[model samples]
Target chain A: MSERIVVDPITRIEGHLRIEAQMKGNRIEQAYSSGTMVRGIETILKGRDPRDAWAYAQRICGVCTLVHGIASIRAVEDALNYDIPKNAQLIRNLMIGAQYIHDHVMHFYHLHALDWVDVVSALKADPQATAELAQSLSSWPNSSPGYFADTRRRLADFVESGQLGIFANGYWGHPEYKLPPEANLMAVAHYLEALAWQREVVKLHTIFGGKNPHPNFLVGGVASPIDLNSDSAINARRLSQVQDVISRMRQFVDQVYLPDTLAIASFYKEWFKRGEGLGNFLCYGDLPATNMRDRDSFLFPPGVILDRDLSRVHEIDMHDKAQIQEYVAHSWYNYSTGKETGLHPYDGETQLDYTGPEPPFKQLQVEDPYSWIKSPRWRDKAMEVGPLSRVLLLYASGHEPTRELARFALAKLDLPIIALFSTLGRTAARTLESKLLADAMQGWFDDLVSNIKRGDTRTFNEALWDPSTWPETCQGAGFMEAPRGALGHWVVIRNGKIANYQAVVPSTWNAGPRDASGQSGAYEAALQDQHTLVDSSQPLEILRTIHSFDPCIACAVHLADEAGDELIKIQISG
Target chain B: MNALKSIPVLVEAPATRDFCYQNTLPLLHEISHALRRLQQEQLPTTIDLNAIPFGPGDEQRLLEFLGRGEVSAHLEALGNSSVWESGYPGIWFIEHRNESGERVAFQMEITTLPAILATHPDDIAESLSSLQKALENPSLGHRIGD
Candidate 1:
């Protein structure tokens, strides 16, 4: 008999995500992924001034906070055919690069490490042994026995006090936990270090955009101005600070994040074999060396890799209506045409409809409409989008650094190329790309400083600042490779106001439910592939695979009706 | 200085009505519950203020309602942290700032003593051992001046 298991309000992620697995004994036969929250940011964006869209769209997800603002601004700029200065482009690159490094490191330590590292077990570890383990990993400065001893003491006190605080409800002693006590202690120590490190690095965003979560964004260019002699503008002091933040970021990624990921992966080598869901991958490349219009200058090139084929890279045209479409067959929504038909985001509609089983209920009616997220398919195929996809795309594109890093990590782990398609590979890919972006940030900063030195410090173009300059009707797809994966904002502006706006975020591509023809989304397919439960009641295996994608459900689902009264209250019970 | 003065300052009028108090009443209720738990079970609870979304003036109003108590402290570690007791005996307000002097966390901890104010046992032991060594060798005390 196939027994069903439900893990609802999945912890350690940005928003509410419920996973249901139909199991035959220990193996998972089928998995259903549902995003239970409705966020109607698109509905809120309708009829608003096109330029102000970024400010509103920035509120979509507090985790991947800056991506939507970038995408939204790009959409408006794309619609207006506005060209910003080279300085603006470089500053934007620095900010985006910082987001990628900051977000990826935090995810590795705070969000996903607990799945592999047992916190409670760290108390039993010998600090001397842990210091030895840490020294072997890398030349991180805080590797002395005394340092590990202090961390262990602090962790012991927190554990003994009967208050786990943020570390509570963890599957600490699960049989599935494979790390040694020393490794666990080392990881726990770095977890605390990462918390402090992240707080410092995010100052990069604050320096440029004025704040961290939902930083200020401008449609024409960045809101920051450059005047070297000035204290308030992008002066010498601020630029030097940006340089310092960048160096700090690169140091952490080089010394701490990279070595820690490899160490953790070495213990869980079996994970590199499983969770290889839907060999397909998609990337909307970002970090342009020149400008957005100059696609060839993109550091991370845009393309689609089908069937994990590194041979031939497929092209993606966001403007092509048939290329990218969202299917709502199993979603809690209805297209004006019908539920079965897929609509391109330019023509995307957000209609509030709840057809799933009401809250405080046992099982979701799996066969019917079950999720709030729309199944975004590229040419009607479920493609995984995230760090693994971006890394694979870069390697396939013959990007030398990405290729070298992947080879180095694979050689270190003694894993084959096929391992890049699995759970652990997805995580290692994030670490590799963080190094790539951190290095690339220095180059961008240098370019910006050189431009300022040459007295070409223009950050904004005032030509299209006035709405009267825009054509009566225009539409554009603003896309970027977010920290999570591919993110695109489709906008249609008529008469200087937003006629329609739809954002197909990264999580929607990976975490949406099965489609009309019964194609499993990335999350569902990965869960069903090579996954076996040690104990059905404690589904640590499920969390490992799901968290590998770094699911941000808040980015996936939108809000409810205008009054918000149409939202269904979901009550989760153990 | 002229460049700094040239920078535009964005200011908005406060909302006519205080929605934060109305919307964040549940937080007040949670504080009450934490107080009760402290009284009944002798248990302490910490509410991360950052976790709660406060509207304009909502945090200030809540702080004003909590008022001030006699006890307050300043601590420096990875950053600077301020802890103070509210008008209510058990409720304490704590704000932690990083090296950049940016507020990292603002929390309302309900306890007899905020955790940051208490010296860790390990630190206490280390302090005792250091003091003993300094007494044995007066020269060791000069190292602090160095």
Candidate 2:
């Protein structure tokens, strides 16, 4: 007999995601991933000024704030054939790089580490033994017996006081937990350290974008002005601050995050064998060294790797209508043509149709339309998008650093190249990429400083600032490799106003339900791949694979209205 | 050259704009639930303020309604943190800042005493050991006061 296990409102993530697995005994036979929330940011964006779209689109998610703004601005720029100054490119690179490092570090410690590390078990750890274990891994200055002792006591108090607070509801003593008590203690200590480290690094975004979450963005360039003498601009003091943040970021990645990931992986080597869902990966490259138009200058190359083939990387063109399309077959949406047909984002339509069962129900009607997220397929194939995809793409593209880091980590864990497809590989890849981006940030900072030294202080190109200069009808696609994976925004502007705007975010590619032809999305397939429930109620195994993708359902699904009148209303009490 | 003088005054004055989404009521309801839990079960609850989005003047309104209590404290660690009790007993507000003086976390902890205000047992043990060492060595004894 087969039983259905449901994990709803998956905690410690940005938005609501529900996972249901059909199991035969201990192993999962089939899995269904559903995004329950609807976000109609695209509907809210219709007929708005193309240049001002970034400000509104930036509100799609609080976590991946800068990515939507970047994609939105790039779409407008692409539509208008706008060109920004070289200084602007370098500054944008720094900002994007900062987002990756800050985001990945935060995800590893705060979001994903609990799946592997048992917090309650840390109380049993000897402080001296933990200190020795931490020292053997890395010379992170705080590796003293006293420090570990202090951390252990604090954790013990919190656990003993019956106020687990954030640590409550965790699968504490699950048999699936493989880490030793000392390792758990060490990981818990570093988790606290990462919280402090992340705050300092995000100051880079504030220095450049003039804020952290929902930073200011420009259509033709960055909003920051480069004036060495002025305090308000990207002056000498601010540039130095940027440099400081980069160094701090690099230090943490090298000393703490990377070492800790490897330490944790060594204990759980079996994880690399499972969670290798659909072997296909996709990346719409980002961090252009020169201009957005010049694809050759991109640090992370854009391409598709099908069947885990590192031999030949297929090219991806966002502008090609047939290349990228979204399917609404199993989604709570409708395509104007038909539910079976896929539409390119430029012609993408957001129609509010909820065919799923009403709320407060027992089980979702899995045979019918079950999810709010539309299944985005590249050339009608489900491809995984995230750190693992980017790392594989970089390694296949012959990026020397990624190749070396992958080799080093594989050698340390004594795992083969095929292991990169599994859940642990996905988590480790995030740490590796953080190191890569942190190092690349320094070079971008240097280039920006040199550009200013050469007396090229221009950050914005005023050529396309005037709306009157634009063509009457134009459409373009803007894409970037966000912290999660590939993020793209499509825009059609007619008479200086947005005619159509659609964003195919990272989560949509990974967390969408099965398609029309009965193809499983990334999350569903990965869950079906050798996942067993030790305790069906405590589905720690499911969380491990899903969190590896770092699902952001809010970015995937947008709000919709049946009447198309009032999209959302906020009730106020005076 | 004074760098401060070069900054242009971009705004003439603070714009009086109405922020439509008032989150104060829901937050107050949450506080009420926590207060009830404290009264009935004697279990403390901490609401992470960072997790909740505050509209324009919503935070100010909530704080004003909570009012101020007699107890407040300042603590320095990786950065500075502030803790204070609200007019309603057992409702405490805590704000943690980073070294750059940026607010990293804020919470409305409903308890008799905020957790950070209490000294850790490990720290107390370390203090005892260090004091014992100082007493044992007359030369190092003066350094304790210093």
Candidate 3:
């Protein structure tokens, strides 16, 4: 009954990853997550001015580059104790929100759908019925016969162009594609529509950062303030365009994304059962001004576990570093003594050797150094971080908008809101949050306009807070929400430059290394119980589910490409 | 009726580059030599350095790390204000005055921190002491010095 299902070279994702699932009968018994290749990004930053870390770090992952840019800037800021202005904060929030909407929409339609909905089956869809479905939804835009026809023509043109970046080597006519021909046609048209919309929305980040695909944002504040004529920073028309784009996103998320998720996810109810990894969730508080200082002011409240029918909860003081420790038992490299220690980020070690199992207590003293990423623990537990954690946190904190949005979505789908604990639930929450965030951004924009009109137009502080003047040794960790999930950058600065810079990225929590106890990371645990419904060798479903976690491996990158390098992603749990 | 003029297709110049992220010196050398060969062969791809941030006053941090001294070329001062986190990545950025009325900028970077540490007096002294007994000349660094 035991079988090893390998999903190597996970396609449609940004980077290379392979999932080796040890399945016992239909359920996964043990999951070995392997990522080969060391990009030497830290080496890439070794001598560069620490300020340029953002510009370069963002390039680590294309999809989540914006988050990395912000995270790197935040880390440096933490070292310098630089505080951003209110206008800068608003601009950042809007830009980051734009990325979230864009990412969520792209993930839903482009990446995740291919796993479930068959594309070639779409060719069989009836144009008339597809048109009818479009017309049925009043709020939906461009859902007409002519629109679908144009979509067909455009897809053909692109195919003729031979620029199939997304659709390359696709499993086009999978028998599992469950939609009728007309419905497929409708979805296909929307898919094309989504791509065009995606391009426009990504521009929102460019308006603030100066370029898309990793826009440059200043650490203390933005590079420059928003002014209409100065040709220095982003122009006025661009700002308005950004605001308009945000509005359009709200419309799309509400009328399109949310509805589409429900429609597609409803068909895959079986996924609701399996692929639900470590029910224990951790969401670091986000939106600093909205919930400043008060740790409880999480847009999503702290931590929740759904064992007793989604009833019980607990508070996690993530400050307890002892709870985090990584294991190299199944890893390739050998540690000197196999002793795991709580080393700061700047002093991170990457000793590469495959000496097999490590001895206890000698973890830190291991003669061989392994991995660029250090295992982070939260009360000695592996925590899940992502849309699920964010939404769950929001639900726990009882944010009115998030609460109502969740309720409305569940009601619309006739789903129990508690079902949000499932994968489908997490997906819905993201789409719902997307719609809600779109509306919230409008209000935030208004507040920004008010600030600008009141002669509070200054955005950046070119001043650097002197860390040398302070006590020679003090450590601080920044906990905020990246678009994907919670992101924290811990910095220790001495003299003038940085002495230590460590980060526990959101994906690290979701796709971390095994703990000192050899327990799996969040995604590994999530993949434990799943039926090998199709080809065990190429389980795209597992890839979809795991990638849905969107692990950020760059945070864990070291000189070597061992599990130790990626161990950073797994915020080890108790 | 739609009428359109017939156009003849001609294949000519297309925009592309032989630029690559050469991670090793061998790769860079190989590409350079290949470009030489290609220039002789009149190949299509144009290989040239697009932009290098290394120049005087650029403070190429990489070079600083490698213990290289600072060199100021033609860099516009930030108006005598040193209160910001701005520096040209610790490497010198230089732009020579071209009489043709054009602009040229390039950066020199060589891991500023490591370079500095490698050439530091204390570190050099330690290395010399470690090799003191290996030679009778009594000059640990004299092998490469005056």
Candidate 4:
């Protein structure tokens, strides 16, 4: 008999998620990934000014605010054939780069690290031994015995006070924890340091966007004013501040974040064998481009890798109705044409149909409409998208930095290239890309400053700013590589207003429910592949694989109430 | 306490704005002090923006006065939460809510990073055995710790 183990609202990720896995003994036979919320942001964008779409669309998720805004503007620009100034592209690149670094660092230390590090064990750690271990790993300057002692003291206080603060409600002292006391202590110290580090790094976003979350964005260009002398504008002082922030980011990635990832990941070398899903990777290339149409100059090439083959990269066409379509057969949505047919974003519909077992049920009615997220398929395939996909895409494209970094990481761990397909590999990929972007961002910053110095201070292009200048009806696809994975926004305009807008965010591709053909998504497929539970009640194995993808369900199904609350009322009755 | 009482609250002359907070002097002083500590020590601090029992529009007024800083993050790991640094270096605003989007925890964290952003050890302990068992399986078809 197969026992179904459900882990609802999987902790330490963005938004509410429920994972139901069927276990025949210790091995998982099948899994279901469900986003327990409805995303109606696309419906909200209907009949609104296409120019102002970024502001509302940016609210899809608080975690990835700028990516949507960028994608939204790019969609409008693609439709109207508007080209922004070169400086604007450079600034946008810098902002996106900062997001990747900031987000990846936070994910590694704060979100994913706890899956591996044993905090309760750290209580037994000797501060001096931890300092010695830190010194042996890397040249990070914060490895003093005093520093470790301070961190340990703080932990002791939290433990003794019976108030763990953020550390509360965790499954402590489980039989799964493997790291020794010293290693745990070292990771705990860095976890504290990363918090301080991230606070300073986000200043770059505020400097450019005026605010960090949901920053003001204009359709043509950024909303920031360029004035070299003004205290309020993008002046000399602010430029230097950006440079300082970049320096700080570089130091932390090299000194703390990268070293900590490698050190902790070294303990769980077995993870490199599991969590490999779909083996089909897709990347919508971004960065290192002056013009949006110039695909040849992309740093991360846009292509699809099928069956883990690197020989031929398949071309991507976001406009093809038959190429990329969303299936609703297994989701809590109804398609106008039928549940079996896939609808392209241009013809996408947002009809809510709840067919799952009502809340508090023992199990989801997995046979039909199990999730609120629509199944997004690329060429009718369930493709995995995220850092792992992007890194593989880069490695397949023969990008030098990615090739060197991937090879070096594999060699460092004494593992072969095939290991990159597993859970630890997925995580290592994020850290590798973070290092790559950390170096690439400086080049973009340099280009921006030099352009400003050369008197090309223009950022926005006003040629097609007005809706009257647009064609009577136009539709276009705006695609970019968000920190999570491939993000695309499709927009249709009629008489200068948005006829329809559909955003296929990263999480939808990774965490969506089953498709029309009963094919599992990246999350479901990966979880069921080789996952086993020592104790089914403690389904930490499921979280390990799912959190590796960094599931952000809020981005998948976007919406909240008047008080900006996302409240789901669950009824429990037999 | 008396020193806090000495600070004068700044009230804008009545105008047509939609919302106004009567007395924000205490909050502003705390923010200012937090900012000073951040600059001086390179520390991160957080303030609970959603938990206060402020009058009708005081939260909005306080946030606006803090102004937007360079970086903001939406953390969805545990719940729906948002963290942003004030224009002043170290002061941060953190707000967390439960699944239904009801505010559960809010604080003004005056540190280099907010406490909510770090992963706790207990979360890892739950999985160690599963990870170890997965490795112990000979059918996994991969070498471990070679």
Return the lDDT, model 1, position A484.
95
Report per-candidate DockQ.
0.03, 0.03, 0.01, 0.02
Q: For each candidate, what TM-score against the reference?
A: 0.81, 0.81, 0.70, 0.78
The sequence of per-residue lDDT tens digits that candidate 4 reaches over residues A181-259 is 9999999988887887887888888988978876677888877766674445786657777888888899899888878
Interface RMSD of each: 10.5, 9.5, 22.0, 17.8
Ranking by lDDT: 1, 2, 4, 3
Say which candidate scores most in lDDT.
Answer: 1
Q: What lDDT tens digits, residue by residue, belong to model 3 across residues A1-574? A: 6766666556655555556676776566777565443565544454345566677667766787687777777666654556778888778778777888898888777766677666556655556677777666546967777777766666667777887776776766554456666666667776767887887788777777767887887767888566644434544445567677876788888788777777777666666666676777766666554423455533445564444123556655444544433344434434444545433333343445444235332122122332333444566666777787777767766678888887877776677765776666666667877886787677677767666656577788767633344544434455666656777655454444444445567765665556566667776777774645465544655765775665556543333222233222223222
Model 3 lDDT, full chain set: 0.59
Docking class of 2: incorrect
Model 1: per-residue lDDT, tens digit, A1-574? 8899999978889899999999988999999999998868888887799999998888999999999999999999887888999999999999999999999999999999999999988888999999999998898898999989989998888888998788888777999998999999999899989988998899999989999987898988888999875445887668767888988999999999999999999999999999988999999998899989888999988999999899989999887778999988999887777889987776677687898876688789899988998899999999899999999999999999898999999999998889999999999999999999999998898888777777888988999989999988787879999999999997888888877788999999999998898999999999999999998888999999999999999899844223311221121111
Between candidates 2 and 3, the DockQ winner: 2
Q: What CAPRI-style quality would you assign to candidate 1? A: incorrect
lDDT of 2 by residue, B1-146 (tens): 12223333353332542234656777788899999999999999999988888853467667877899999999988889999999998999999998657898999999889889998898788778888988798577643223
Pairs of colliding residues, candidate 2: A38-A558, A38-A559, A39-A557, A39-A558, A39-A559, A40-A558, A40-A559
Off by over 4 Å in 4: A558-574, B1-146
Over all chains combined, what TM-score does candidate 2 have? 0.81
| lDDT tens digits, residue span B1-146, model 3 | 00001112243342532122222234345445544554576432222222433222123222232342444333233212111111432322233223222233222222222221235687678667656754655554344332
Q: Write the per-residue lDDT of candidate 2 for residues A3-79, one digit (tens) a residue.
A: 99989979878889999899999899999999988868887887899999998888888888789999999988887
